[model samples]
Target: MLVHTAWNDLPGSVRRAVVARTGPVRSVTPAGAGATCRLAATLQTGSGVVFVKGILVGDRLAWTLRNEIRVNPHLPGIAPRLLWHVEQDGWLVAGFEHVAGRHADLRPGSADLSAVAAVLAGLAAAPRPGLPVRPFAARWSGLIDSWHVAGSTLAHTDMSRRNWLIGDGGARLVDWATPAVGPAWLDTAFTVVRLVRYGHSPADAEGWAGQIPAFSAASGESLTRFAGALADMWQRQQDRAPAAHRGLLVDAARAWCRYRSGRSAVLMSG
Candidate 1:
């Protein structure tokens, strides 16, 4: 099997350092990835399983790993267990008990939607210790603004089904670098759009959005406004992305626009 590492294109020293720290590094298997390269590896020393996230070695990456560790602890059962860090190879190696399941295509009747929503609710309800209570409100408000700015909520900005891992009883969310403390709706909206873009029915997207209270609490801003602004931002982001990713973004933006516009009309009619 092909083992994927972030610095696989780099020198042996880098790979070696990661191997030495983790274990024998039996094989580097690409695990969950989309915009970033992720690898799952088995250690020769019986180290079990380890995930290596490639990052340019620096304070920024350091801050990211630190944030992962800090947030993981507070998230409890909601997040993956952060095992260890390997700084030498410019890879952040974390060991999590491998979850057994595949990515949900996010269909209307799919079981994955509820699992994903549950995780989102848990994340929205989680405490940030020193992080302010209204930590998500400000960014959400900005997104609501016509200016169309990204929110600061510790949201799993990339709530793609790709990041959600399904196991026996529940699903766990991975990838923490993009955490934003914005409106809870922002996160849910992103997921809902992703599902809709992937061909899930409008009702499914609405169903998922309806299940979350954090969506309302964190985004005291008008839901329609936030949805419209996010769709616009998503479009701009799509423009800058490579053609491949742009397609996904385009689909997602359309779904977002459709839902937001429909919601607005409904409110006016009521």
Candidate 2:
């Protein structure tokens, strides 16, 4: 379990690093939600408010904080701008331009769906960055067919509603800590599972995904393989270490696989 550190409790070296950039700190408010990070807060400075997230240097997931710093620059307007990053007193912290927006509501028929679609399309067009992160095929090697993993597109991978912000400009993706270079449609596929969690049936979630150009262009055979791969992956994760929400995700993934299986049957019959 992740333990949150109160802003006042941050080591002096870390606070000094933040103050160097933002000047005197007026207040600190916990901001955003995620299980991966030990600290996420908005610091009010004399200049302005900036969002900062960090983890202990010894934590295994500390590398993800560095990855977020490296990936945020490539995201452009699709994510909050990275102001700076600091490593001090056994902690790694990154500051970002604060975005005052609510978590996107992704239930069926919400206007946020279109914005989510637009964001996915934009991400599909982003240039691939030079990163050593594993490709989708290699990451899920045995779970998915090798043929479907041959694309250089950069994918955010994790598209939960908590990772999105519905701001004045539209939906913006956040927490790009687990980006991958893989099929352009992979992110869309991940979102389909999230849509299922948000009350959309598997069929409806797949329908929403199909509207995106990248996803629409992908072959049904590949999509079915991907769907089954995700189901298997989530089921294994749940079995090894049960999480309250992991079962829901596993159910959603299985539902998507069933939908694809039925579609494949129909196609074969025709």
Candidate 3:
């Protein structure tokens, strides 16, 4: 997890720059330890509420936030609008419209499933705006071709519970901190693991994934390879690091891989 910076920790000049865009800063609330930016917060401002994400100019991770800014402009209505951005006091910050919502519940039988599906469907249909977005890692090249990843427009490669929010309007995906160029079906694939993690059986989770046309069209061979490749990639990490274990997704991938091989019919929640 990233060591987050509180809103108050922002340099005075940086805060002033943000205020100029937001009117007056009344309260600042950090959005927890989000994956990329150094600062992520919701601020109560004189004009209204604005969510902000930022990074120090010299931080090695600044590229992540920069990609976020580039991609935000072309995002669909399901994403929060980027209101403004500022660079001051060696900090770079971007302000967004503060949307109100609760985290999506992806567990079995939850009403939020369709809502989450809608967001992914729309995201798949969205036109790829021109940007310097990178391709999916070369390590999974076989998964790439089988899934037709090269045919993708734009994808929010990271799909976690926290990245999805359910508001009165339905579901909206957030945290484009690390976007990628991959098959439209890839996000749906990422989501299958989430469904399995939450309680859905592999068959049931895949049944849910099948509702998305892209995933539905995926060949069984491709789906099998996708699962195996995803599992293997992180397993290698655990092998080398012996410590840095972000293995929940890996475990989910393994379970699905096993089921695809006709190995079992159970939801193995590790």
Candidate 4:
């Protein structure tokens, strides 16, 4: 029962341009919505079904959308298929080939873990040309020193289980805008949190975290420092988000923190 947003009201020119390329849109289904002016809509077109991520116009909004479209294709099947993009109208609309799959949830299994792991693995590999890398390394390096010790090739900063879409074609990651140019552990840690929420054993989570340093080091960032940066990032997001959602994120972070702290105790005991 998602409601329409003012963003849903596309301008005549934008509508015509889309129809011209894609043909009349049969319907626009609300796929998902998130904070920060991001709305995912399923656009049914005569050619085929596509997903439109409408980002509000202005500010640095256009750059974020542009960054996503630029990097998503580099990841190929690992990410959604990009169709087209236009910055003219108030909203930046980028179309992707529809991917059919359920979001990752808290359920224990090898496949889910493996799928998530693969995504992180891919990120550790590296980013392609035409994408900026220093933004991540510089920020990560700064965080490491500021916090203490610390770090994706692919910047899937929002790699919660929910972001991974497992479909018949293959497992594809949605929400590409968050991609960055840093160590893979950053994304790995982010993804691990989601699995932990699904009730993954503390041992498993710790094991994953322990391995993060090596992965992140490939990008020249220390695990300890990167971790501090991540903590700060999470806090900033919680602070910036609306009050209602802030509590939710804070609770989630608190739970994960508790689990992580307990793991440290176990390691010390061992």
* Candidate 4 local distance difference test against the native: 0.62
The global C-alpha lDDT for each of the candidates, from Candidate 1 onward, is: 0.61, 0.86, 0.79, 0.62
Q: Mind giving the per-residue lDDT tens digits that candidate 3 earns over 130-215? A: 77677764435654463445554578877788889899989888878778876678789889988887878888999998888878
Candidate 2 lDDT over 60-159, as tens digits, reads 7887888898888787889999999899989898899999899999898898999989999888867787766668777777777787876889898888
Rank ordering of all candidates by lDDT, starting from the highest? 2, 3, 4, 1
On the 0 to 100 scale, the lDDT of residue 23 in model 3 is 88
- What's the CA error at residue 129 for candidate 1, in Å? 4.5
**Comparison by TM-score, 1 against 3, better one:** 3
In TM-score terms, candidate 3 sits at 0.88
lDDT of 1 by residue, 38-78 (tens): 34443333477655554445434445545665566555676
Candidate number with the higher TM-score (2 or 4): 2
Using all chains and alpha carbons, the TM-scores for the candidates as numbered come to 0.75, 0.95, 0.88, 0.76
lDDT winner: 2
RMSD of 4: 4.3
Model 4: weakest 10-residue lDDT segment is 143-152
Clashes of 4: 14
Question: What is the C-alpha lDDT profile of model 4 across 41-101, one tens digit per residue?
Answer: 7888888898877665764555667777777768776787788886656767788888878
Candidate 3 C-alpha error for residue 255, in Å: 1.0
Candidate 1 vs 3: which has more lDDT: 3
- RMSD of each candidate? 4.6, 1.6, 4.5, 4.3
Sorting all predicted structures by TM-score, with the top scorer first, yields: 2, 3, 4, 1
